[model samples]
Target: MINNMNKFIAIVGSNSNKSTNRELLKYMKHHFQSQAEIELVEIKGLPIFKKSADKFVPQEAKDIAKKIEASDGVIIATPEYDHSIPAILSSALAWLSYGIHPLLDKPVMITGASYGSLGSSRAQSQLRQILDSPELKARIMPSSEFLLGHSLQAFDDNGDLKDKVAAQQLDGLFKDFLQFVNIFNQLNNAKEINVQKAKDFSWDKD
Candidate 1:
């Protein structure tokens, strides 16, 4: 049995108050209470990222980075915006990566919700590539994705997933993420090298 101490951060990749992606993450936090401690984080109100010679990292971004650094894993719920992720989420990532590598080599689970049937498929795919980039280098849970289609109708009034099959799928994927966290932590062969490489990629270099 997995320990209850397995803490995770679930990032709501939207700025809107009425986001279905946020709703989906809330459901997971309640449903998986026995398995892990999932904290919901918001990307709202972060300023747009711009390259600076001073390598300024916002206090908000640094605070979020500290949370991520202390957590065992991360979960991101994204909504599709024109076949991609929202600009706010993209900017949030840029802030997280600039001179700060909290997500580097972190275990991550990708989930998405959409109003249409495709269920944010394109956004998730694009997110994968972004996470795989050198600055991010997140160890995303392989071969596992939870896509919620018609998400407006997916959950009931109590904020629980109404579809049994989709709920079961999320259960399995979350369990896999727990194991992925344990396994990733065991591989320390190149941990130091990876960290140095991420730090070296900073624009505030000589």
Candidate 2:
């Protein structure tokens, strides 16, 4: 069971630089500032995933996996490139599929902003499809889509979310996301308790 005091959340993005996606994640962190510990995962050092090298994934990948395992929920903010999620995000997700499967049954939410008319909605949709693979086991938040358009002009040079309406929409999305995650956590705790009770009964019968 996750202690309310110890619960943590991880926010991930594709770019290592001052990306708009990262800025969105920063805003998310601020929204949750008083509620939970939010850790931003850096994908800069993660290597390209290779199937043959299952025995030794890169240290960076391992670090990310550990963080995912420790996190109570995950928020991803990714950019669109060619109507798809960035290659770096893809690589990280691919690497996470091996061994530990940190995303399995984990609560996840996705949001993004773009300079184009479609925002990063196309890329976010592609990522949702990828995350829905049977192997992932993610409890995806359906209502948490934040597709901010005109990304370059949406924020000031200081990286604040400039659009008041967009900010409010994002806030609402985060509130829903928090409720979903809390319910998931409760269900997980109940399942664990039931399993422990069953195990205890079996031991007594023997």
For each of the candidates, the C-alpha root-mean-square deviation to the true structure, in angstroms, is 2.0, 7.2
Question: Weakest 10 consecutive residues, lDDT, candidate 2?
Answer: 197-206
Candidate 2 regions exceeding 4 Å error are 1-8, 189-206
Worst lDDT window (10 residues) for model 1?
197-206
Candidate 2: C-alpha lDDT: 0.74
lDDT values, one for every candidate = 0.93, 0.74
TM-scores, all candidates, are: 0.95, 0.83
lDDT per residue for candidate 2 within 133-206, as digits (tens), equals 64455678985678988887887766678889988987788778778888888777544444344334321233
Q: Model 2: clashing residue pairs?
A: 105-137
Clashing pairs in 1: none
Error at 55, model 2, angstroms: 3.4
Query: How much is the lDDT of residue 95 in candidate 1?
Result: 96
